[model samples]
Target chain A: MRCRAAVAALWMLTVPALGQHQHHHMAPPVSDSLQWRMPPMDMSMPMMPGLEDALPPTQPLLPSMTTPPQARPGEVIPLADGDTLHLTAGPVTRTINGQSLTMYGYNGQYPGPMLEVQQGSTVIVQFHNHLEEPTTVHWHGLRLDSRFDGIAGISQAPVAQGEAFTYELYFPDDGLYWYHPHLREDMQQDLGLYGNIRVHPGGEPEAAPVHLEQLLILDDVLLDKHGLIPWGEEVPTHALMGRFGNVMLTNGVTDFAIDVRPGTAVRFFITNVANARSFNVTFGNLPVKVIASDISRFERQAFAESVPIAPAERYIVDVLFPETGTVAITNSIQAIDHFRGEFYPHVDTLAFVHVQGAEAVPDHRAAFGQARENATVTNDIDAYRSHFDRPPDKELELSVRVQQLPLAIMLSMEIDTLYVPPVEWNDAMPMMNWLSTGAQVTWVLRELSSGLENMDIQWSFTQGDVVKVRLFNNPRSFHPMHHPVHFHGQRFLVLEIDGVRSSNLVWKDTATVPVGSTVDFLVDMSNPGSWMAHCHISEHLQSGMMLGFTVEAQNQPR
Target chain B: MITLLPFLLGGLMMPPTPGVCVWTPEYYQIALLPTRRVPEARQAEGAAHVSFVESPFGIAVTRAGHYRYKLELRVSGLREIEGHSYVAWLATPDLKDYQRLGPMPANNVLSTEVYWNKFIVFITLETAAAPEDASWQGPVVMRGMSRSGLMHTMAGHGPYQQEPCTVYGYY
Candidate 1:
């Protein structure tokens, strides 16, 4: 422990002390509730010729914008088969943590109304962009047509200001999916403009004994006493580690609470909609059975104490509450404390489940105790296994490159290279991350086979082709941070990690490739359309770290 | 350049339904008949038709990936014994490992669906309580192989690489 502590001390001392002239040092404690690890902005000396050291979020908003009316919680709107709905994006005023703040919303709510549709049914959404800038709603995890996939520059152009676009969406798979802005997700999605889509089986609900269900959209907002710490007007500022929010929100609100009956099985459809932060969700550290992944149910259910969810990823877990006892639904993880020179447990209370009632009428506790064997997912993925052992058809390495970042930031990153954790639980260097804008930092997705980076690489495949792709998070880069990679029009199986084959498989559209880890997946090119794959970190995506691909239609018979 | 115009809905096809799975079953074929143990090894006279069913939603009509395979067989001239029952079994194409799929629910019909990729389906005559260990302890009665199971010709590898028989051995 002493040796490990010394090593952590070396990482904590990222900046050298060139004597008060210009040095990056950990500031004194800002607040008793939250400890800030950023360099001291008020420390007389500047961070080696940087603009001004930094702006701490604890400061009050100098010019506070008028908070609109208090926004209401997002509503659930269920649409029938072939229903047409109009979705408008506009500004909504919300009181976050006793401070009135302004954020974007769809249909005048913080989170757009949850749209519940049936499987295999087509619904029309006439989306009107009421915001100031252009935006396109990318259905996060759907196998819809290329046009309705909502990706700007690929399927269709962005909905310009005062323009409207109609989306004919079909929910091919019945599970939890979300929609957010594909253009400028760093600003649009971070300030709201996201919602859930729950597609149920067309016929009827399954016999799975789940009683009550909860849709928990997990998000985090970077806010200070002065309201939302301003977004970068130039380029995405937090491109280094993306924006790790200080305040965690559940369903776009703080102190969220739910009432549940004891001895009843509740299925929680949890989605991590945060711009950067990945959550390790735990319901008071109790056991929960993971039923479904992003696209569909897992071949085998996993019983886990916590679920690690990356950005843009969704997981469905069923929890059977005991007789009584309030359970705090939380995201608990170990965050690195550079100031204290150690790691500390950080638990954010996202919500609470008040379980104080009699057992449910039709108690599904017995059936919830057992997991089902799904033949469908197994058979669906059978074809992809053939390419599992062969050499990967394509390989991409994830890393960050900088052209002209400030000296202080570069010095700190170079020194801290000695110890970079597998998963960055917290923004250890918030000042450096906040200053590393898109102009200087370039998060790259380089194809190893062709030596092409980002947009320069174009991967093409035929429909029904099972393509194997390897994602390696190169640890030798300037700064290696875990990235949640998302593919637009395909569902993939996490085939293996590093060299070990993954025995438990689940179909997913987004997965977190941890720092220095190697992930191999098989993309089922069943959807024919121009698609894109990129890091889901909103700011990282803004830093030109994305690639486009094509899945040509099987225009002929096999 | 990316396509800017909306895709034609008519051009889109309704693909296979994304099926439900919480656990996977080993791909095995039940191809057995008890007549081999009898004098002269009598031939079992029966025919079965196996088809794929869509996930509970019944979405797939033209596409065929996500399917739960079902076999329906009606064999004539089957003698029923007092202490024995007809059981359906799934076995590796080589007839080595076996999994008991319980006794025929009703009549002389084996009405059930399986998810095995390539395996032989066979029937067996076992005591009322079939063996639990997937061991071959009963008399083989009938054997039927799927088209995918035929990927492996009796001649080893035979230039096909035999992936259909090897890689899909998912339990």
Candidate 2:
């Protein structure tokens, strides 16, 4: 009996370690051996009374009240004009103590509308642009036709003011995606123009019942004393770092609270819609499990102390409520200089998970099956490293500069010639009169090495030849460079940083390159297509920091 | 008029004046009408009645009935001024205040070859206290100017030197 008890204790200790290794998909037997070294103890209960042996096996409590919204198999939903969706964009307006302001919206909400569709289903949406200017909707992270890519002037024409465009989107995968404007995107998105999308997996429903599921669209918004700040208004100087909103909101509510029963597992689909902010999100005390990222589900559930979500990113995390109390999920980066003055810790409460009920639900850790058998290598790591060892196929460098010129006197002289003198001129003009400096500053991206007006590259490669890209942020400039480097249609491995490899490296479509830092990544051009590699920062891209290279079909084209 | 003379004299009295060149101001006369006219009538009648006035500085446009238009002035017959540019903006009727607009993208000197007929400036004038026109129109005109030296450009791009030029119109 003592030996049996020892074996049971050893099993408990090794479970968590095994779980981590399986989630990351380290090597096979090596990870198994590493897991056996740890022992698991019942951390939930410190001590068990003598009557523990007599206790019956705990059963999961009667299924919680909430359940995921049902999606019929092969279901297709069509969103026509005049269908209203109720949503709020920023934190609870009442707590904000500012004038009620309106932002870009569809069905009278900032995020337009949420369009939920089943995988392998076609969704017909009649999109409309009511803003004064032209804008187009880009279904971000969605695999769609290049013509429907929604990049104004690139993939299609902008939806003119008061214009409507129809979309026939057929989602190929089941995951979390989002939608936002692609014209003057930095300002429009900041003014609250985004929404969440969920494509449910298609197939027979699994037997395991989901108790509670919710969609949490997370965003930070800058608000003025009156309310939502006006578009085109001059922002503060520190905005170069990033713009931190005066208010933070989840699902348009500041202090949104959710109720959950003890031990009830809930799935949350979280999307960060902030313009440039990255969220370090955490639940105050409840432990959470991440199940999926932007594109696909992970091989196994992974637990994280906090999840880091950059702009236009999404994650799905499952959490089991522990006790009957308020659990706060908030942005964990409080003191970090997130561009604004000082990071006000817990400035916004994403959502509150309130647990209720006495009986504890049986843990489903054993029944929760793995989503994928193995974490398949999406990118070739060794080939990626070797590509980094050699020189890049091509190098492109860009710079950002700021200077002032005399504008007021020139304007006055023109006015005089026009025969109408301005009402107020010639008194000592304030220093802030310059356009773009205090009120508006224009940033330019100029190619330094090649005088090529257009950034179009043509290259030929074999099926699996790894292409290396080396991006350097020159230090001679004054402003710091924070670029979200993005590649189209493929994922790449960040092989080296400066010159070293990191085991914790993860595959990503976009990665941030810090100021004065050089980052190198390699992509196996297995997919033959003209792909675009550009800075994901919408403002920087608008300022012309973009380039496109073609992965030609081998032996087919010049 | 006396206040305007002293301001003009003060501008001319700069110790190291950078080769001053003068041009005649063009003028136009406009008539204010109580009712909105047809597009053709508004264009043909307004243009026919407009007059041009030539001043020592440049050309000024004048017209009847709250007319609004733009004037382009070009400075010619001067060597390229190094590191200096002409700054201009609209001023109040008393010429004591300036409204910032934007800078003219040209070199410091006004040459007919550079800024065809000097710089193009916009002006609007309205007789009614509240004009219903969708465009800019207000009575009372004044213009402002200053000659920026090369040294001024050397110091950190001349703080706020790019403030847009403003234009005023009086009926």
TM-score of chain A of each: 0.89, 0.65
DockQ of 2: 0.01
Off by more than 4 A, model 2: A1-98, A120-122, A202-210, A233-239, A298-301, A334-347, A358-362, A365-373, A376-399, A405-466, A474-476, A488-490, A496-507, A523-533, A549-558, B1-171
Candidate 2 matches the true fold with a TM-score of 0.52
Could you tell me how far off, in angstroms, the CA of residue A21 lies in candidate 1 after the best superposition?
14
Please tell me which predicted candidate would have the highest TM-score against the true structure: 1
Which consecutive 10 residues in model 1 chain A have the weakest lDDT in total? A55-64
State in Å the error of residue A300, model 1.
Answer: 0.7
* TM-score of each candidate's B chain against the true B chain: 0.54, 0.24
TM-score of chain B of 2: 0.24
lDDT of 2 by residue, A1-558 (tens): 999988866765553222222222112234212111111121321111121121111111111123322211111223332343322222111223344444445444534566777777666567766566678877776655445657765567988876777765656666777777777666677656777777777753312344677777777665534334323322322123334455677876566788777767778888877755656667775555667666555434555555656566677777666667878877654332111111123334577888887644666544443332223433424335545568765444434544432343233222222222111111111111111222223333333345442244434455456777666544333343456666654555555544434343344556655333445667656545455566655555554556665554565321
On lDDT, the candidate that comes out on top is: 1
